[model samples]
Target: MITAPITLSQALDRVARERPQAQAFVAPGERHDWRAMREQSQRIARALHAAGVRHGDHVGVLLGNSGVWVQIFYACAMLGAVTVPVNTRFKTEELEFCLKQSNVKVLLTADIFLGIDFLELLTQVEPALASAGGLPGERLPCLRQVVVLGERCPAGAQAWDAFLAAGDAVDDAQLQACIEAVAPDDVLLIQYTSGTTSFPKGVMLTHANMLTNAWAVAQRIGVSADDRYFSIRPYFHVAGTTLSILVSLMTGCCLLTLPKFDVADALQMLDAERCTLTSGNDTIFLMLMGHPDFDRSRIHLRGGWAAAGPQVMQKIRDVMGVPGMCNAYGQSEASPNITLSSFDDPFSLRAAGWALPHPGMQVRIVDPGTGSPVPVGEAGEIQARGWSVMKGYYNMPEATARALGADGWLSTGDLGEMDADGRMRMVGRLKDMFRVGGENVAPAEVEEVLHAHPAVRMAQVVGVPDARLGEVPAAFVLLKDGQDSTAAELTAWCKSRCANYKVPRYVAVVDSFENIGMTGSSKVQKNKLRAHAVALFGLEQPA
Candidate 1:
């Protein structure tokens, strides 16, 4: 096995030198081999350097899944600059807040995508971008440049082509100096975890933290240079950047990226590329296998990965023919990989949502308040200690102190239980647990039961305020296309399968749930769901 690259720039350089002709990235209009990817990154590095971005400086990026996104990331590596991947779905307030909080010096964004003009949006967010030279102020003092990744750049933005051209004068010696100054332990990426709360915390992951976790994930999947992956996970998330993109680069595998997932298109791409591996959240897999045109015979899916309820993971393996699919679980703070179930694991272990822990990671199920280990087979907050743990939350010292302990264990804020066999099962998120008449209801457990219904494509359970019970479980469900089921019927199904109190008292069968309210890892924003449920039910907000 090739040793992991110490710095991300080294990963690009080493791969380019060793496999110059191997395909590194595959997209609809653009394809780059290892050498070409490295060269493009150099041009981007020059462009960024010319834009006045320097080592340790934060360069914010807002774009969809594209080759340009990958190019910008590596460009930051080439200059020891920090890459802050902003969620493309951000609105005016969120965009302004993230740029200001991260102290972004340069922002690389798309001119037009998904029918929204991003340059116009930026102007609305900062207002300073209305001029040829963006106004500097307390809100965005460090922000000096905004580079648009398209033609006809806005007044305050640099055109994509012009940005590349400006890099022509940057000498190799200057670039080398920047790259050499980087170390394995230096912060490489600041990935913000999207929360229902107004402010999202920027998780600071060093090169070592991300690369080591990526290496472990690659090892578990047994990826190789010969592998071809149909990648659809959003590039803004760690699931996309660290697991999918970094794994492809680490193993010299070819990755075909879909800017947005289309079931038919994804299937066609899988067959066209003869992809050996693919991965996404449970919802993505459900959409793929549940598609009317889905056929197991049409594609090559040797293996893949999923982080969902065990039943969903089982369906992914059984239905998609990737029987070797692994189960992964973690939060963004741990470079997003805590435990990954191996393909060779026993059905009991895999089904229980436990696999061998990633190397160098220490996990424990401790009482949330006492910080003491819970008895085996008992649920508690999961804590992690290792290289993968993020350094801290950027500019949020109080939040960081609350998250990470002086003992080096980072409280994951997730609830799980480890069995005597050393396998662990995720119960649910601590915050998502609701009590109906003083009985604890883990929303995930109920959602798992709801998923068992053949007609249910997606299900989210939230707590609604109650004058009598303090709170009652309410479900917002999305049914499969061309399938029919009513709230009454689904409520009956749940009541039949679970305890009386666990069954949702209220069910709303909606055409579609709010996808924006979900986190990148496919977790439902229960807080948002709860608020929606409360409003829909006309219940008074708890004082």
Candidate 2:
């Protein structure tokens, strides 16, 4: 009964036809209706084609959450050109790797956005872009052109106005031909996963994969055209693009986006837009509640969409006065949506980290050691096979093979168990587990106990190398404002709550986890945390 659009191009066209005058998206100082957006996308696609971007070509979009960013994404889809979302936080070396790996042909970028000048970075990455006769780099042989999304473009890059005008040379009929040529199974996006332990892998996802996932998520969250969806996360992240942005598009909701996440800025947008639903994690919600400007009277917040524990979700709903909560849990590889939670569900039926799999998705739990399904109510590695699953990792065949089993199931790596009611509860990732002596320890179990403490705001625990025990848990606690608690006191508190092996051997109360590295999705890079812990403790780790 639920028939979503087959491709991004088709979806945009359908929406534009049905609701041409409806508000599509709004940002800090810009707004676009469906008709305008569709026309803009068509013009951009024609310009890209004139610039020699053909089908299956990779077009890198290097910027924040702006109208131009969304325009370029749909433009690429119209031309059947793959959109390679380049992370703004990536350094020169990481940028080099992404460009070389993706073999991007065209780059649609901005001169400056989010306090970062992408044009400056592009010049540094490819110096020829600043000089006459921009030549391809030895490393990036496939890249042909760089389109800057502002005035005063660099030597090798085309200006935003000029690029738009270039489309005038091509007729609308020619652009329509390109749009009609695209297929649903064609790869539309290649999102690089946030690699915590190893190098990031580009996950190839088709329009079908994204559309289906967004449809299920939108339906479960009860999204509608009447709702104003708040998008706080970055456009580069899966949560931002597929979950929040595309979900809004699928449901015909007005997407209110911000370039960056600031407590004040978010509050202002929510108040101005009267946002009915907000999309973010626990960190964003906690900051919103704690901000000095936080006044419930000004903002009409009806609900929030986020992934967190039951206590936090309840706090987000009942305590924070943002009821009609929404929940989602999945990595980028599953077209990023595997499970969902509805706000209408009663608290008695809702357990922490439990989200019912979508009817279109097939979820299974199997023992890590054996390829057999575990008994119901028992924990095991979570696997998924369904419409939402990704095609595979782009240009990484062996990595793809390792993730997708021969049995047609994608090994999700996370450990979880299924309840009698058929809901899945993720316990912890297998890689996140550490052995304290001969006993195994899951950081989540310890972190859960720490979260229960009155003073502790949030916690991230990791395994640090120990000479005697081989590995012991190290805790990083972020306490609430005006709350006081010592590392010794927290350790004692955790000791009283959890098992000996699960208890953290040491605790470090930190000011900013951002001083350590973080993934684009706001997840703590535990590998970096472990290395930092080792250096802090003056301890050696296994190479």
Per-model TM-score on C-alpha atoms: 0.96, 0.96
Question: RMSD for each model, in Å, please?
Answer: 1.8, 1.8
lDDT of 1 by residue, 213-321 (tens): 8888889888988889877988889988899889887788888888777788898889888988988777788778778778889868877677778767777767777
Q: What stretches of model 1 exceed 4 Å from their correct place?
A: 1-5, 135-138, 520-523
Pull out the clashing pairs in model 1.
Answer: none
Give, for candidate 1, the lowest lDDT window spanning 10 residues. 513-522
Best by lDDT: 1
